[model samples]
Target chain A: SAVISQKPSRDICQRGTSLTIQCQVDSQVTMMFWYRQQPGQSLTLIATANQGSEATYESGFVIDKFPISRPNLTFSTLTVSNMSPEDSSIYLCSVEGGRGSGEQFFGPGTRLTVL
Target chain B: AQSVSQHNHHVILSEAASLELGCNYSYGGTVNLFWYVQYPGQHLQLLLKYFSGDPLVKGIKGFEAEFIKSKFSFNLRKPSVQWSDTAEYFCAVNWGGADGLTFGKGTHLIIQP
Candidate 1:
């Protein structure tokens, strides 16, 4: 089991502004995942952040809009650039130990409201 | 891309009533199934997961799920539900190699006391 924490639990931001959400895990992990959940909806995978290379984004998502940074195994940050009302959602971070760990732990999720 | 479908969007039940949530996933090949619960104002917690071995798996909070590969379904069930079980339930699926896990729309459960 891993303990994950996110900064800025809930924030209200204006349109066109960007907000970077931080995720910190207690243990080092090989893969960190970012997910987005719209108002009263299921979660959608945003990207997969590895410690070294670029993040792997889903088809509907792009790197420019949701830039991810994973400088170390225990930490990663996701920035929602040029935010809009449609971007308002709860962003979550999850971690796994890789190699058949099977279990993935999630953070409290950052609720972002765009105006 | 894999997808998950949940049959019910909202379920209302009285305390001590039986609970069952339908979950079906696309892709018949080997897959991992999981049920996650997100209580009011809380993070998503893993209720149970089925990887291999027995198709019938039990998880935390008296929750159990059956993995029926023939039907591509992993339905969650509980014998008796309490008012505390009022929360949103999400069923997720993954192939075990990738980082992305496809999630169902989620079922909003309101257990009346």
Candidate 2:
């Protein structure tokens, strides 16, 4: 199992501002994913952050709104740009427990509230 | 579009009470099923998973789930729950090794002391 840590466990930001959430893994991983959870909702996949490559985003999500950077295998960052009240959600990062392993391990998540 | 469904929104039970959370998926192909738990103010953790194995699987913290392929369901169960078991549970499904998963709305379990 991999231990993942995220920064800014909770933050309140003003609208139109941007907040970057960082995810660090104790071990190298092939793929890291970003997700969002609105209040009282399930987790939604935002994008797949690949090391040294552009992130693959899911439907209804784009890089311009939520840009991602993965400079290495053990580190990745997701930025929620031009925030709004709708962007007020818990952003989480996750990685597969291992290569070819289906189980996933997730970060504690950054709870961002846009005011 | 492929999706997952969790029927219960919130559940309340006394300590040592039995628990079951229903999950269903809407994909018509081979799939992998998982149950994850999120403790208050914590990250999501895997409770159990089902992937081309015996229908019944056991997991940490005395949690278990049975996969019913015919019904497209993988329901989570714990014979007895503790106050510490109070958390939000999410059901997820991944199709054919896609490396991507779809999640259910999640069920909040409140185990009263």
User: Top lDDT: which candidate number?
Assistant: 1
In the range A1-115, model 1's lDDT, one tens digit per residue, is 7899999899999999999999999998989999999998899999999899999999899999999999999999999999999999999999974565345789999999999
> What local lDDT does model 2 show for residue A34?
94
Candidate 2's DockQ is 0.71
Q: What does the lDDT come to for candidate 1? A: 0.93
Summarize candidate 2's per-residue lDDT along A1-115 as a digit string, tens digits. 8899999899999999999999999999989999999987889999988888899999999999999999999999999999999999999999986535456788899999999
**Candidate 2 on B1-113: residue-level lDDT in tens?**
89999999899999999999999999878888899998987778998988877999998999999999999999999999999999999999878777667899999999999
lDDT of 1 by residue, B37-113 (tens): 99998889999988899999999999999999999999999999999999999999887555778899999999999
User: Candidate 1, residue A89: CA error in Å?
Assistant: 0.2
Top TM-score prediction, candidate number: 1
The positional error of residue A33 in candidate 2, measured at the CA in angstroms, is: 0.1
Clashes of 2: 0
In model 1, state the lDDT of residue B96.
Answer: 58
